[model samples]
Target: MRKIWTDGLALLGIALVLGGCATSKEDLLPHDHRTMLDIWNVETSGSAGGGPAARQLLDARQALRRPLTEADVQAAPSVQARYTRTAANEIHRQFHRLPNPDLLMYVFPHLAGSDPVPVPGYTTLFPLYQRVQYALPGERLEDY
Candidate 1:
């Protein structure tokens, strides 16, 4: 019984030492004093204008301020067209849809019940275009 008790105590001591090592060393150190908001405020307050990130942001803003040349304006449409997407392209993407056209018809009065009853004339509507039509780039909204 004494031997069993000694062995148990030895096992417990080993477990305690291993458990201490299992904890991260970084966890033993003090936590950060500043919150996320504090960090963001410091970065955006312009007080750090000498920092590399601030200089880069200033350079980008200056580059954007440069006037666009005539050639650049002419090329803008092609660039916009390449990047732009039509309504039809968006609808047809990721889903399958059949082209169903709308039709308009007038139904004449008829009598075709078990006891021949008169039916009144009525008008019905359906889609004329089979597929969805998308507006062209730079097309006027008023035209649509």
Candidate 2:
């Protein structure tokens, strides 16, 4: 009984620690440049020199948010060019993005259940469990 009590306390502490790390919906919501850049490493590659232009746009975005009044909108001309190229590239990319054949089965884990959600329908969703949290019963926080 004493051993079980000790184990329970340990598991409770761990769950609290891990749950604190859960990603909130707020984190995934789009924000300004600083936040967007945190996840996406945007590059303007192959469009009037994408690398430098993209960086300049990033810098310009920072500058725009500051008190500085002298920032010319065209200060990052290369970035504009890159943006145009990127826009075109994006349209092209849409053609390349196709639905996977395996997705049909993946979506409908159980064929008998009231018709499963479409595969692509849930593509944008995230994983429910992390590898670190894959513990059984008393060994995990959920158990506690």
Candidate 3:
């Protein structure tokens, strides 16, 4: 009887939770279709850029902002060109790969497959090291 009561209470609790979750998002949210910008303007209506702090921020920004002259615009290209990547600058080649010797392998001709067909011999080259190694910048990549 006690187990039956506990099971009934658990079912009631689950039904209550499901009922709470069944409310549509449209019912929960404001039905008035006000835009985000409209809401922002309404919220900040009385204090829009009129506060002392806002005035000080605007003044500081005005002081920092400078109009670019024709000379400044012309000089911009030279400054950018100095830092631009070129073949002579060698900016991309920061790390040098360490040399790994290739090992030559020759496969002898043999009969292969269920029908026993003659396979031609071939030569192949493989790197001695399993993985390629790279030297850090300023490290001696050349053999001494």
Candidate 4:
């Protein structure tokens, strides 16, 4: 009885799937066909192209607009320049890397491995910290 019920559901599911595929794309869509771009253009057409909502929005924006004074124009660059990341600002200012003092170590001449080989003495610099550290935002990283 269980096997018969399972088989009947499986047959019904297959029939439904086949029935869904029988309807052509043409029948499913509207009689007047339009491309996605055409639909988007119609939907997004602005005040000039003539939508009442768009006209109202444009009028509101125009009402909010104010003419910039000479002082305003002059100060604009200074305000933007403060936050602008240039080579000088990047190296010296806000995003400066935390100071990690390098240790100068002199390695004496030594012999190693199965076959003894003479290694010349040399000075190498290693940072005090294992990894490079960066300053947190608004943290004072200037040398005291």
Candidate 5:
């Protein structure tokens, strides 16, 4: 009995020690602190590696410094016209309307006024059309 108790206690102690060592360094940090550390590391290390990306960035900066020529100014309007969308086109682009079936509602003819004037019964009823249908996946309206 004595030997069994000692062996059990020894096993428990070994398990506790193993568990302590198994815990990761990241497990000790709070969630928000860990996220902040990750963001900080990315920002600090991102620009450290300089190569073709750096050269491309330098080229872009130089392009920005160059003065605009008369040809560039003349081409601006045509470029703008190609990209610019009208108000109606913009409205159509932003909103996605689903298709709904038309519903025809009939108003029953009834007497009106204190004099009880009889209203003529008519079959005329306006049919309410459903809103515009939206373009879904694989559905093309125009070049997006």
Candidate 6:
């Protein structure tokens, strides 16, 4: 009985500290893009071609899909999600929509929830938000 009490208390303490690190993922998410980029760096060339380099990029993309960041953490609330699918599948489905071209760079973090999602069949990306063009100096949409 005593051991159970102590263990429970210990678990509670750990949960509080770690949980306090974060709670709400939605707000944490835009910034979570930082974590997403870290994933991209290790996985892909952030390039156009789907040669050996692009797959490597996709690999890097899959690694850091979870939202864990200490840089700006606070006592925010967390989101809990569930799915009928297998655990891994929950994650796969989230980013499954991204085109293969942007898989590693743009898609991973968008998925990687607590729920299981499906991995897309093709290694290539869809047509939406397919290409990312950076803003030129003093350039806005009207400038073009």
Candidate whose TM-score is highest: 4
Q: Over 4 Å off in model 6, which ranges? A: 24-144
| Per-residue lDDT of candidate 2, residues 12-82 (tens digit) | 99999898779676787745555444334446333344577678877888887876344556566754554
Against the true structure, candidate 6 has what lDDT?
0.54
Better of 1 and 5 by lDDT: 1
Q: Tens digits of per-residue lDDT for model 5 on 16-118?
A: 9999999988789645544655664444444445556656766888899999999999999976754467775565543444444456566578898999998
For model 2, which pairs clash? 44-50
- Candidate 2's clash total is 1
Assess candidate 6 and give its TM-score to the true structure. Answer: 0.17
> Alpha-carbon error at 15 in model 2, in Å?
0.9
lDDT at 42, model 6: 49
Question: For every model shown, what is its TM-score relative to the native structure?
Answer: 0.31, 0.18, 0.35, 0.41, 0.25, 0.17
TM for candidate 1 is 0.31
**What's the lDDT for residue 91 in model 5?**
57
Per-model C-alpha RMSD: 16.2, 23.4, 10.5, 10.5, 14.4, 30.1
List per-prediction Cα lDDT, in the order shown: 0.73, 0.53, 0.80, 0.79, 0.67, 0.54
lDDT of 6 by residue, 25-121 (tens): 7666555445666656544555333467768656777886757676325433321233235576555543222222333324432334578565544
Model 3 ranges with Cα > 4 A deviation: 1-92
Distance from true position, residue 30, model 1, in Å? 3.5
How does residue 123 of candidate 3 score in lDDT?
97
- Give the top-scoring candidate (lDDT): 3
Instruction: Please give me the total number of clashing residue pairs in predicted model 6.
Output: 20
How many Å off is the CA of 50 in candidate 4? 3.3
lDDT of 4 at 121: 93
Error of 6 at 17 (Å): 1.0
Candidate 4, run of 10 with poorest lDDT: 39-48
